[model samples]
Target chain A: AQSVTQLDSHVSVSEGTPVLLRCNYSSSYSPSLFWYVQHPNKGLQLLLKYTSAATLVKGINGFEAEFKKSETSFHLTKPSAHMSDAAEYFCVVIRSPGKLTFGTGTRLTIIP
Target chain B: EAGVAQSPRYKIIEKRQSVAFWCNPISGHATLYWYQQILGQGPKLLIQFQNNGVVDDSQLPKDRFSAERLKGVDSTLKIQPAKLEDSAVYLCASSSGLPGLATNEKLFFGSGTQLSVL
Candidate 1:
């Protein structure tokens, strides 16, 4: 069985500040991890993915996540936050082909 | 390229009523997926299709939910006698190929249909 846990339900940060959204996973195999963002009234958009190639994966909009096998974590981070980044973030774990197990999600609120 | 397309961006129906949502995958993509997203929750995979063949439907509730992809390009998901718990967003996504070998193929998503059960 595979599962993902997003540590925070909601995170608030002011624009230009550093942003972090924590996630941890449990997978039997070498897992594929992803970060997706969903804006208000919009569908999900892929941010980035880690497939065991590079431990440090860079994604769109200056967002990135590092795969730490020892910690079982793939936490999303950005050097500086922007108001447009405000959205619901989902941490996803895929243990097999075409089967994705998603975390509950963390709502990011950007304060101006 | 045109992205995944879905129909009926919003719908409201009474309990026990039936509703259907449509999806068109990206051009030449072989895999399609349907996911259910409740308020404040992540999207849950309900079904997966590889072209016209079913890849996985283990999480789909056959008693009230059914889906099909015709011609291996377009798909539809139907919910019969919907329950209050069925009120949520139905998202459709398509990928180019299997993972690992095609790990870079990110899922292209549709706008999704928001279903509201009264």
Candidate 2:
């Protein structure tokens, strides 16, 4: 079985500040991890994915995440927060083929 | 490329009523999935289809929920005798059902249908 846990339910940061959203996953085998973002009334958009290659993964929109095997963590990060970054973020774990499990999303709020 | 498309962006019905949602995946996507997302929770997979064939439906509430993807391009999910718990977002996603692909094959999701049970 595979599962994911997000460290925060909501994260607030001011514009231009660095952003961090924590996520941890557990899987029996080598798992595929992903980060997705969803804005209000919009569908989920893929941010990035980690599949057993390159500990450091870079994604779109100035975002990145590090896959740590020992810690079993895949925390998403961004150098600077933008107002447009305000949205709900989800951490996902792919246990098997076509079986993708998602963690409880973290709602990101950008403060002016 | 165009993204996944879903219809009836919002629907409202009373308990015990029936409702249906439609979805059209991107061109040539061989896999389609339906998920139920409750408030404050992650999306749960209800069913999956691979080119008009049922792939997995273990998590679907068979008693009241049913889905189908005919011709392998468009799909529909139907709920009968809806319960209060069924009031949530119904999300549809699609991806290329290829073999031995691990990471780059991303799943494209639609803007989900918001179902409200009164």
Candidate 3:
């Protein structure tokens, strides 16, 4: 069985400040990890993915996540926050090829 | 290059009533999926189809929920005798390439249908 847990349900940050959304996973095998973002009334958009290649992965909109196998963590981060960065973030773990187990999600708020 | 398309952006129904949602995948995409997202929760996979064939539906509520992709291009999901818990966003997603090969492939999603059961 594979599952994902997001540490925070909601996070608020001021503009130009660093942002971090923590996530952890449980999987029997080496899993593929992904980060997705969803805006209000919009569909989910892929931020980045980790497929056992590089531990540190960079994504769109200046976002990135580091895959830590020892700690069973894949935490999303950004050096600076923007108003448009406010959205719901999901951490996904895929043990099998197409089956994805998603976390509860973290709602990020940007304060200008 | 068009993303997944879904219909009935919003729907409202009484308990025990039936409702249906539609989806059209990207051109030549072989896989389609249906997910339910409750408030403050991530989307949960309800069903998956690979070119008109059922690939996985372990999580679907078989008694009250059903789905199909007849021509392998478009799909539909139906819920009967809707419950209060069924009030959520039904998202339709599609991916290209072979089934069970999604590590490299990406799933494109629609805006989703927000269903409200009264």
Candidate 4:
């Protein structure tokens, strides 16, 4: 079974500061990974995905993530933090077609 | 295109009571999923349907939870004799029904129904 672990329960950063949310995955085979963000009272939106393509993947809202097989990590990053970026982020791995195993989640708070 | 639509944005019920949530996925989507998101946790897949057929329900508590996706479009999740542990935001998502390995199928999610079991 494929699973993911989010390193931080919560992360705080000042506006204009860089943001990093760490995630590590375990899968027997080369698997697909994803990062999804959920804002307050909103739906979860896809941030980025690594589908065995490029090692570096870019997503919406200036967010990006790097897939490192050697490290078994797909950490999300951004050059700067915005107040609106405050949300709960989830690192996900697909155990199968309909099964999407998710990490506990990491809450990101931007300090203005 | 319109996003996934869910009804009764907020629901509150006493323990052991029955509750149901409705969801309308994006048009033309063939795969629908229901997820339970407990506070401070990521969404957990409860059930998945591929065009009105059950694809996965291993994590679903069949004793109290039930879900259906009739006609391969809309879906409803029902919980009878609910427990306090069942309190969570129920999210409905849909995809194009691509192969399972296609992780980038791009799931469209609903705003979710927040269920509070008192």
Clashes of each: 0, 0, 0, 0
DockQ of each: 0.57, 0.65, 0.62, 0.68
- Of candidate 1 chain A, the 10-residue stretch with the lowest lDDT total is A93-102
Candidate 4 structure quality by residue, lDDT tens digits, A12-104:
999999999999999999888989999988899999888988999999999999999999999999999999999999999977775688899
TM-score of every candidate relative to the true structure: 0.96, 0.97, 0.97, 0.97
- Model 4 chain A: weakest 10-residue lDDT segment is A93-102
CA displacement after TM-score superposition, residue B49 of candidate 3 (Å): 0.2
Interface residue Cα RMSD of candidate 1 after superposition: 2.3
After superposing candidate 1, which stretches have Cα over 4 Å from the reference?
B98-104
How far in Å is the alpha carbon of B53 misplaced in model 3? 0.5
Q: What share of the true interface contacts does each candidate keep?
A: 0.54, 0.55, 0.50, 0.70
List the candidates ranked by DockQ, beginning with the highest.
Answer: 4, 2, 3, 1
Q: Which ten residues in a row have the lowest lDDT in candidate 3 chain A?
A: A93-102
lDDT: which is higher, 1 or 2?
Answer: 2
lDDT of each: 0.92, 0.93, 0.92, 0.92
**Model 4 agreement with the true structure over B9-116: per-residue lDDT tens digits:** 999999999999999999998899999999988899999899999988989999999999878889999999999999999999998865544655778889999999
Stretches off by above 4 angstroms in model 2 are none
Question: Tens digit of lDDT per residue, candidate 1, span B5-117?
Answer: 99999999999999999999999999999999999889999999998999899999999999999899999999998999999999999998863455445788898999999
Per-residue CA lDDT of model 3 for A5-102, tens digit only, reads: 99999999999999999999998888889999999989999999998889999999999999999999999999999999999999998756566778
* Candidate 3 residue pairs that clash: none
- The true-versus-predicted C-alpha distance at residue A43 of model 2, in Å, is 0.6
